[model samples]
Target: MFELIKKKLKHTDGYPYLLSILEHCLQMTYKRNGSQLQQWQLLDRILQQIVLQDEKGEDPDVTALENFNVKNIIKM
Candidate 1:
């Protein structure tokens, strides 16, 4: 599911509701334990952009996050 979302994020103009669905899923993850949802990598990658941006004091940088990994994604 998120694999498709990841792809669509690059071309959201073609998928109007992608962000809405993404937000809903994100809230769901926060409301429950994310480890069992097969969402670790999805959340990990989605979150890496923000974490990197926060740490570096810059706009979210997907390039910087390509190979990054958060040790404990569920706690983030």
Candidate 2:
């Protein structure tokens, strides 16, 4: 299921959509049982892809912090 979604998103425009899907999968992993490890692994792979796709060549830490800050603001 996750692979299918990821493959579909791979052809689409914008990293925001990928980020949103990653966030959703992260939340689901936390809320579900039995498959937590698999979900985390998938999320890790997705994060790697995001970093590779990043055009600014920013440090991963900085990019992650910026993403977290934006998400926090969106929640508030």
User: lDDT per prediction?
Assistant: 0.60, 0.58
Best by lDDT: 1
Candidate 1 achieves a global lDDT of 0.60
Compared with the true structure, what per-residue lDDT tens digits does model 2 show for residues 1-76?
8687677777778556777866786577353444555456555755765666657765545454443433323232
How much does candidate 1 score in TM-score? Answer: 0.24
Residue 3 of candidate 1: its Cα lDDT?
Answer: 83
Model 2: runs farther than 4 Å from truth?
1-26, 31-33, 54-76
What TM-score do all the candidates reach, one by one?
0.24, 0.30
Model 2: how far is 6 from its true place, Å?
24
